[model samples]
Target: MRTFRLYGGFLGAAEVMTKPVGLTAAWWQVLGAVLREPLPVSGIAREMSLTRQSVQRIADLLVERGLAEYLPNPAHKRAKLLRPTGEGYSAVRRLTAAQHAFTNRVSSRVDVDELRTTLAVMERLIAALDEEGL
Candidate 1:
């Protein structure tokens, strides 16, 4: 569909900007969520609407690569809290800076209010799709 194409194009542009740091879209999403709040693997999975197993695998890789760490979760007997290491923080900062620069460049040519309205519409569409289990 036309909307899918538009979404794909937007994702492609984001990939081009973020791939240099070896961060896939999924990885970035997981990392960004973790950065906002240190969470157990189950918490991250629930927040991101992903499987816990999948998130654990990625978290394991991040830990092994020294980008993230697993610390004992005091609130849970078996869960481990996931937190970003210094390297992960640095990567996030770089990725966000690049994204901001790209957005600023594009926004300079467009009316900011129009851009915001378009984003609101797109977000509504995404929420609808999510509600329908798309």
Candidate 2:
């Protein structure tokens, strides 16, 4: 229950943080996923644990807004890779300072060791769930 509440809080924070950049939390999430490398909407959906159709809709909106662009995928002809445009990258980058400050403030209130242990436990839980196909 605490974890669920924490997740909701984080999403709310993300929405607030992204609003000034003209993005919603969902758009920020999808854009952040492809910052390192381009991927198809299905790929993003899989990584983000969202439906392909939902991701497709968001991807289309991003492209339409000139925040992202589609590129040819050498591996899959039909599945175009979605890459962030200059404006997209800039928008995400703009969040960096606020994100860093937020993290710093949060970390300051938590014990480092406790945080590490909690993170480790969370990772283990994720791994266990993945292994179980849950």
In the range 6-125, model 2's lDDT, one tens digit per residue, is: 999889888888888999889999999899999999999988878999999999999999999999999999999999999999999999887788789878999999999989998999
Query: Which stretches of model 1 miss by more than 4 angstroms?
Result: 122-134
lDDT of 1 by residue, 55-86 (tens): 99999988988889999988997899999999
**TM-scores for every candidate against the unseen true structure:** 0.76, 0.94
| Residue 40 in model 1: lDDT | 96
Alpha-carbon RMSD, each predicted model: 2.8, 1.1
Measured on C-alpha atoms, candidate 2 has an lDDT of 0.93
Q: Any idea how many clashes model 1 has?
A: 0
